[model samples]
Target: MNLLLNLILQEKQRIDYMLERYQEELAELPKGTIAEKKVNGKTYFYLKYRDGRKVVSQYVSKRNLEDLQKKLEKRKHIEAMIQSLEEEKRIAVKVLEG
Candidate 1:
């Protein structure tokens, strides 16, 4: 039926959009944590990440702290959106099949 065809096309477009967004959002992720250390009343910041079994760290300037945090949050949000898209794809597939 025309309705089913339209539904499939709309779902396909939505999936394509989500996939493109996923790829773009991946670049926004900088998977790491900002850590602080205090030494002799002086404070220091480090960006912490994992490499296999070992943990790696690098210095993060105070000026860049906010930017990194926003990137991390964006990455997390994208991950959640990807999961939601998976469910949408499943339903769409089922609809197409039935």
Candidate 2:
């Protein structure tokens, strides 16, 4: 039982560190979703996100759209990992307590 408890404690620490790192990465990555608009038969992209109390939309040129989209996708993946780590940490804590 003691060995199992020690392992759980170690796993909890690892999860905590991973959660912190993922959160920091998430903060550095781009935020918001891409919005497509058609104007005069030409399609354009915009990066739409909320700023404070207002919704902000910034035009994204074709050249930068791919890079921006990649960054947004990375951000989403990291966010999901953070959530999973949090849940794991919660379970670890529950195990430690019991």
Give me the runs in candidate 1 sitting further than 4 Å from their true place. Answer: none
Shift in Å, residue 19, candidate 1: 1.9
State, as a TM-score between 0 and 1, how close model 2 is to the true structure: 0.94
Could you tell me which residue pairs clash in candidate 2? Answer: none
Give the candidate number with the greatest TM-score. Answer: 2
lDDT of 2: 0.94
lDDT of 1 by residue, 3-81 (tens): 9868786986799788788978696578778899998998888889898988999888899988988888888888888
Clashing pairs in 1: none
State in Å the error of residue 54, model 2: 1.2
TM-score of 1: 0.78
